[model samples]
Target: LLSIVDKLSGDSGIGRTLRLAYDFRNAAAYLKYLWFSGEGEFKSFLPWGTLEPDALRGEIENILNEQSTDIEPALAGAVEQARHLKDAYKTPLAVDIALDRAYYRYAARNLPEGEYFSRWMAVMSDWANLKSFVRVINFGLNRKLFWETFAEGGDIPAGKFKEAIDLDTDSIPAVFIHTEYGSRLSDVIKTALGGEMSGLDLFFRAKLMELYRYTRYCIFGPELLWAYAMTKQEEINTLRVILRAKGAKLPFEMIREVISVVLE
Candidate 1:
């Protein structure tokens, strides 16, 4: 996997940022795993390639203090910018938008290998935008603040996402009807209205997996590499979520909803 990341990330700092994103993910999962075991279901996914759960080092938040030197830097700049925006806006939403934009922008740039992979990045962006729009409506977020989260490189128009804020549930899906998510927007809206915001995220996640599953038969190419990476990340993410929810003792329905996505 490291070799694959290295091969794909050879384009500027984008590849390095990809590794850094994994570092953050693994570290976060390790910490949560520790919290669950009070020190240890998660043994397999806890790769510990970076986290060092037994070392008991300082908090992983320290990753935020990393310097972005030209010789070696990942998503540090993006992380720092997100931190700044978080402080300025007094909302975590800024951080979410900033990091996501950086990750996608870099991922899209790094994958010059195939247009299909590039389109994957674009669809992922659309999902992010669509999900953010759902959150804006559900949480009553500031109208102007939603624009800050708008990302480029997606089929969906920025204006369409902007117009969705004033829309009710019945009317929101129509805004995206002409775009990549036209057929799926209905379910996105239905799941959002079903009262579980997490479900909306899972809905898109399942779509990405569906999108990539067809490429597995490819004997060779960056597409296969991406498929494997996406599948692995899906495992890590799903397990991480289930473990956290279990550790927190959330309801079974919540876990079941997420598990269903993975099962599909």
Candidate 2:
């Protein structure tokens, strides 16, 4: 990335974009734990951290005054959504959902437009909503409950999601048929509805791999860095999956089934 930026003319600040993003992105971790209870419940998607609730809130306040942007909407939405989540303090899901929505809607800044990474973030936001939506349907959750978590910047619209989620379970897949993800995700929805939940996880990884595989063919550019880093990350993720499965004594076929998606 520095190499690419160096080759550009003066006043090109793309080199600094990623660093600025990480500064606020890391701040999100502190915001998500604002309701933490030190009692050690499995409370978040990210790994547990040492910060207490007070400290987390203080950190969020600083970010809100600093970035003076997303940190507000992200937690502000959660403040409203919290009333609906009766056990909001016990689980971080509501806040996490709020953050997801605010993140795509406002958090993205300074991305290199037209780059794969920018598109990747938008698509990941969509997939995250899709993954969460699937659970809402399968678990009989209220369709309205998902609105706070709905993300922007994707091909799909929030109202489109609303209409789809309002449908009966069997008819839901039909709503996505004309969307970009239709052909690839139609069967994924069916498989998830069939209760093979692990398939959804594999599908997410597979779609990410498929969408970015072109980076691997770029022989002379910053994309080569993306391809190399993706390869390494996939290797580590694959090994981690295998180790966890083997540690649990999962059958050989099961281990193979999960790891196969890493490369595909």
Candidate 3:
């Protein structure tokens, strides 16, 4: 990327464009490191020694401010959607549904609303309906009870789990992060959805990438858009690791540790 920028230095107009391109590319690399590395290393990789949630929120705000200038039409709609998210809806599931709606509406506006879009819209609707039926009885916030309940594959005792839990027991998507094209996770989603599922790591990264691609032209875009857009190859690499561990039916502790690391 640096080389690409250097090669364009002689042309003033192109040089400025190349510089921004390089900055975006480098930012992506750092984002990848955050998702793929362990918590300790991720801390070491940052100046503040932590992936502060507030910092993330601030950074996103900054980006939106800049985007308002770079692309006013796109950013304006995004801001309105974000406003709706903040003042009205408070739950993750609610936020997710709103984003999905904004994304599909944006897609319909830009695309021909072909069969592909129709199918995905249906799938998204089904997922939303399933989310509504998720049994979210309160499980106490104790770590032991939380882990035990998750392991037992049943509802947690009152006060053990999060109040807004939306973990669907019937249709959990698993990504086989380590496996190749013929691997279980990739093949299943690919056959079911029908798309360019190859080249995907078929784990968290693949799921995220699908979200990113679907919503790139949307009004509000995805919440993880920055992380998804920035971290390309390396982000998917760690996803493969998580999927492989899952497929092996490893102990819950082992799987949880890997997931916590990836999502940190």
Candidate 4:
């Protein structure tokens, strides 16, 4: 995927955004590796953007060897923020939430505003925030943490999430009533609140697939490429689910239930 995105040339906005997204993922992974393993090696990491793989490896090694705080500033900053939150709250989830917020913020800053790709990313961010909200609420975690974890750049304002956190489960859908995702995802939100956690990803994937359908009419553009990439990812996810089910010797019906209907 990184190679394919890198090969695209001449005003490929989506490609550039994808490369940055990949970089964010790699950077986060590198930080997590250092935090857990107490060592840094980029042998298994994907390389893209302005950072060369060899240079990144060397920098990571230097940081590990000298116990230096010097690393890629963006990733280093995110890790530091997460570490601060973890120290204050003593929850590992703070690390994930901080990294995710940074990832979405990076994407939003890099992508052009008001474009389809940017809107799609906003929807993704909204879905992530919604998922985090559901988890925090359902698990009886601290509601105050939501404010810190909320990723900016979503179509749904952070204020809406703050308000929704106080509402009854039945009234939660009202928070999104005016947004583009409201109609499509309202039922999913209700279902998720009812304890169907898997529905969250299922609903988001379905909406994303539906969004990609419009790109089918375009003869040429990044939309088609984006759709293809999304479809391939869906396919990969489906295969992984099926493979896991088979390995576990799960019933066919059980496997079928976990399979996403959007791809079918």
Candidate 5:
């Protein structure tokens, strides 16, 4: 993935955004290293983006040495959010949410206006927020935490999300009635409310496949590459699930339920 991203023209937005995505992942891992008291093998980290290994080491050392203010804005923002959560809630889950919010924020900020990728990012954010809502309700977690974990720049307003929490399963669809995700997710929301966690993934993957199909009509541009990348990722995920199910000697029917369909 790193090599592919590197080979793309410097002007390519998709390539630039992909590198940022990996950098955000690496940044999260670096924060995890600090949270664990630097116990892990630092050499095992997959370094990418503008941060070289030596530079990343210096940044990490600076963070540990109380010079966090010098760190880059994107990473520093994520670390600061995690730090606040640690001081207050002291939960590892909060750190994950912080990094996720940072990543989406970075993507939304960097993506060009009037592009399909920007629209896709909005859809992605909505799906993420929806998943967070479902998890919070299903686990009986505090509703206030939803605002902290929510990623901005989605088509659905944050206020709508806040309002949706108070809604019953049947009423949740009304919150997104005019949006693209509404029809696709309505049945999935009902199933998820009934405690079937996998239903959400099923709905998300199906909707994503539908979106990817639309990208096929683009004759030239980043959308083609982006669609291909997303398809490959889904294929890889499906394979992993299949292999794991086979290793466990699960029946085909049971295995089929957990795997997503590949759109050709």
Candidate 6:
């Protein structure tokens, strides 16, 4: 994988980022396996001579960081620019609009959640300055929906769970069926999906975010989120290909088939 990344880094034109990203993924998987097994002299294989695993995270971070000066600079610059662009919005509507723009306009959907959400929050901070309503609505919505996740055993803190869901039972008929969050993940998921019809919007995005978060932390114990990220990575490359084709005055119809709607 390291060799592939080196080769991809040296290559020019034609989906270079995609090739690099693909190789990076191979490294990520290998590092994940090593960390999970908690065995072997993994340090011997790492190119970073003196680095050691401070946590399970050391391997992948080292690869991306130590790899040529190019990777770190590009990643840092992209992060900085994303944060800068997000600061332009100054209202709830503006914040949402900025996110929407970043998603489709700048191919922001291709970024990892850490980078993507950081950008979102930076934009949101400006929007909050213009209108307190942004925080009120956003926090109220998040806190209310967070309890629903708590009540459904969504890996949220147990101590905060009960208080968060302390709302009128009479107003919420669905909560009555599942009095406490189930211990079993299967039960939690079933109740979350089959019960409750009031908070669909929050539920879906929350679920996606949770899946994305865990997949990053836990690797491919669940397949969907990893697939989603990779799918978006491919989309980023596809968009670049389209831009390049247009610049070179080539037909784009054939390239369109290469694009995928989802990572899988």
Once model 3 is optimally superposed onto the true structure by TM-score, how far is the C-alpha of residue 54 displaced, in angstroms?
Answer: 15
Worst 10 residues of 1 by lDDT: 67-76
Model 2 gets an lDDT of 0.58
Deviating ranges (above 4 Å) for candidate 5: 26-61, 68-72, 167-179
Which candidate has the highest lDDT of all? Answer: 5
Candidate 2 local lDDT, 1-264, one digit each (tens): 334443441343333432333333344444444445444542332222223444445545655455443334444444445434525333455545554554454435433345576666667777778877887777676566576566667766776677787777788777776776766677777788767778777777776777568776655454545444445567777899889888999888977877787655
39, model 2: CA deviation in Å? 1.8
**Alpha-carbon RMSD, each predicted model:** 6.4, 6.0, 15.0, 4.3, 3.6, 18.6
Ranking by TM-score: 5, 4, 1, 2, 3, 6
Give the per-residue lDDT digits (tens) of candidate 4, residues 137-189. Answer: 77777887777777766778887887789888899976777776657577778
Clashes of each: 1, 0, 12, 0, 0, 2
TM-score of 1: 0.68
Q: Pairs clashing in candidate 4?
A: none
Best candidate according to TM-score: 5
**Residue-by-residue lDDT tens digits, candidate 6, 50-162:** 22234223434544354323232333233233233334332233323222223222222332445433333343332222122222233443332222211111223344324
lDDT of 3 by residue, 124-229 (tens): 3333222222312222222332222132111222222233233332222233223222345434443433333222223434444454455555653222232233
| lDDT, model 6, position 166 | 45
Q: Which of candidates 1 and 6 is the stronger one according to TM-score?
A: 1
Stretches of candidate 2 above 4 Å error? 1-92, 102-107, 194-196
Residues 1-264 of candidate 1 have per-residue lDDT tens digits of 655666764543334544655444443344344333445244433332333433212333454546223311334555556666656555555556666666676666656456677678777887777776776676666766567767787788888876766777777766666766666766667668555677568767887888678786766566766676777777877898888998999987867767766565
Model 3: how far residue 122 lies from native, Å:
2.2
Winner by lDDT between candidate 3 and candidate 1: 1
Better of 5 and 6 by lDDT: 5
